[model samples]
Target: MVRKPVVSGMFYEDNADKLSSQIEDSFHSEFGPGKLPSKKRTREIFGVISPHAGYQFSGPGAAWAYREIAESRPADTYVMLGISHSGFPSCTSLEDWETPLGTVKVDKAFQAAFMERSGLKQDETAHSQEHSIEVQLPFLQFVNKEYKDQLKIAPIIISEEQRCKEIALSIAETIKQTGKKAVIIASSDFTHYGMNYGFFPFQDNVRENMHNLDKGAIEHIKSLDADKFMGYIDDTGATICGRLPVAAAISACRILGAKKAKMLQYYTSGDITHDYSSAVGYGSLVIE
Candidate 1:
């Protein structure tokens, strides 16, 4: 079964040519407060945390992470851990995903291996309308344009935060024993602030407070402290959409021997819309 694109026209361009052009533009665009990082050859880039908002808002940040992945060329398979916005079950899907660019084959072999080890169910309902993982496909397609057929995906929706460590261990063990080189991607956006998300912890210095809140979570992620990441989220009630997924990726990356994580870019929708009244944060990071 092929999982059709649900947010194509809404979150990104639906036309093939337009979508490709938009992605290429995003790659060429400057990110953060400076020029994007120059591409450098690196070894063993195991994981990345990428935002899943619209291409116009989060695309530059996403490009920074994808550019790093393109430079490293870590693996043939990408394990995508996405938050379930549709409130679906926590599971993995073994169905090809359709995007404006083309269809990305599902790595059934890897999915089976992971499910066997983790005891997670295989369900497509969880992925039916989820946009988090879907939005990242175009970037991967553009980055791997030369080897599009060589790329495969294992998409997993994370619903249970408490099971993250166990799931990560199982995934790590499966990859190690199978000798399959893979990269993990956590799809998340940070701190939905203002009355929109009802997460108003501060009335003054809203932008500064949001940055500090998100930075605290990023610090735990950079440290590869999964427990601390989760604890920080729970204690602060941070409105990070993919805290569980990020924690799982951190745990898996730690098990895969990844030491340091580098923040590629950080910004919010407010930066784009010039409306800080209601904002959502986005960040890009790579674990090595």
Candidate 2:
């Protein structure tokens, strides 16, 4: 079965050629790596933390992460962890995903193994309307065009941060048993500020404070301290959308022998639109 794109035209270009061009533009945008990805791979990456927002707002951040992955060794599978804004319970979908560029296969064996090991429920309806995971596919297709047909993903929706470690360990175990070279991508957006989101800590210097808030959390992620990352979220009440997914990625990547992480990009929609009144922050990172 195949899951159609839920936010294709709304969040990004829906037409095939237009979508392809839009993705390329993102890679060359000012906030992006400022260049197209190369085939040379110097290091290995195990996980990625990407933002889920309209491509116009979050694409540049995602471009940075994808650029690194494009150059790194191509993995057979991408374990995608996303947050369903609909508040669905933590679950997995065994459905190939369709994008404007192409269809992404689902690693059914991997999904089955993970569900058995982690007890993550299988539900296609959970993924039917979520944009978090869908937005990343075209970018993946662009970067891995050489192996586009081989693109496969295991999509999981995370709803509880407390259960992140347990789920992550199960994912690590599944990967070990399957012997598939895999990369885990946790999609998230950081620090949703403004009264619109009902999260306002400071009255003055809103823009500066926003940067500081997101940077604090990024520091913990770079250090690979999942506890500290969760604590930072709690202590500050930062409205990060995919906190659970990121926490689980930290645990899984660490268990899989990833040493350190690099912050690919960090900026807010305000930076893009020049309107900080009601903007969400976006951050991109790679764990290696």
Candidate 3:
């Protein structure tokens, strides 16, 4: 089974040539890394935190994470984590994911193991409307030459925030049992501000306050402290779209021996749209 691209031509380009060019431009964009990913991969990456928004608004920020990923030693599987409708529970899919770049197979071996170990169910429909996971695939396709055609993912759409630590333990154990070198990718956007989002924590000095707000969450994430991260979210009502998945990622990374995380990039839609009134904050970080 194949899950076709859902956000193409909107969140990103529908045409392959143009989409590829758009990604290239994002790498060189003023908000982006200002250069392409390196040809060589010598570093090791345990996991990453990426924002899942339209390319124009969050692509540059995402490029920072992908640039580091592109240069890291490849993983046998990328465990993609996303958030679905509330109360959906954590779920995985066996269907291959299709994007403009092409289709990437789901690592069924890991999928089965993750389910078996975590007791998470397999449900394809849960991912149909979620862009959080789909948005990261093209970036994966764009950066690596070695795994271009052979890329594999273990796609999961999580909904239960309370069971994140338990689910993460299962994932970490599954990776160890299967001997699959893997990278956990948690897709999320931070701080959905403005009246549109119904979240106005601060009225004045948004540019400064927004950074202060998200940086607090980033500090917790960088320390790989899922408790503090989620606690911060609860305390502040940060409006982070995929907070649970990010918590899972941080938990799993910690279990997998991730020492620390480093912030790769940070920007707000206010910075892009020039409308601080209603904006979302995007932050990218790598756990190593």
Candidate 4:
């Protein structure tokens, strides 16, 4: 079964040529303020954090991370931990995902091993309408175009924090046991502020406050402290949509012997729209 994209033409371009062009543009586009970390191609990246939003809004930020993955030469499979935006509970899908670029085959062998180790059930409906995972496919498609045949995906929907850690550990064990090289992609977006998300935590300096809050969370990620990352979100009531997914990826990376992380880029939607009244933050990071 092929899982058709639900967000194409809405969150990103639907036409194949247009989508490819848009992604290429994002790669060359100038990222927001602050000097981006220098891309080190020799270091092996264990995982990455990419934002899930409209391509125009967060594409440039995401490109920084994907560019690193492409430059480093990724493994055969990618374990994508995405938030359940469809309000569904946690689940995993074992179906090929169809994007405008092409169809990405699901790693059924890896999925089966993961399920046996993690005891997570396969629920196709859980991924039916979710946009978080769908939004990241184009980036992967563009980066792995040369090795598309070798690239397979294991898409998992993350919900609860504790459950995410447990599943992540299982994922690590499976990778170790199978001896299959895989990279984890944690699909997430930072703080969603203002009345739109009903998560306005500050009255003054909203933009700066949002950046600080997101930076604090990013620091935890940089340290590979999954517990501290989740705790920071709870303590500050930061409206990070994919906190669980990020925590899961961090924990998994830690188990996989990842010791360092670097922030690639950070920006908010407000920077583009010039409307600080309602904003959503986006960030990219690479864990190695």
Q: Per-prediction TM-score, please?
A: 0.95, 0.98, 0.98, 0.95
Q: Model 3: runs farther than 4 Å from truth? A: 85-87
lDDT of 4 by residue, 58-168 (tens): 889889878877777568789999988768878899999999999999999999999999888899999989998899888998888878887799999988766877888
**For residues 1-288, what per-residue lDDT tens digits would candidate 1 score against the true structure?**
799999999899999999987877777766632333345546569989999999988888888888877787647789999989878767999999999999999989999998999989988888888999999999888777777888899898888877888888987888797788899999999999999898888888877888899999999989999898889998999999998889989899899999978888888888778788999999899998
> Every model's Cα RMSD, please?
1.8, 0.9, 1.0, 2.3
lDDT of 3 at 276: 98
**Which run of 10 residues does model 2 get worst, by summed lDDT?**
38-47
Q: Once superposed on the true structure, which residue ranges of model 1 sit more than 4 Å away at CA?
A: 30-42
Each candidate's number of clashing pairs is 0, 0, 0, 0
lDDT of model 1, residue 157: 87
Q: What is the lDDT of residue 131 in candidate 3?
A: 86
Q: Across residues 112-204, which tens digit of lDDT does each residue of candidate 2 receive?
A: 999999998988898999989999889989999999878899999989876789998999999998999999999999999998999888878
Off by over 4 Å in 2: none
Residue 120's lDDT in candidate 2: 87
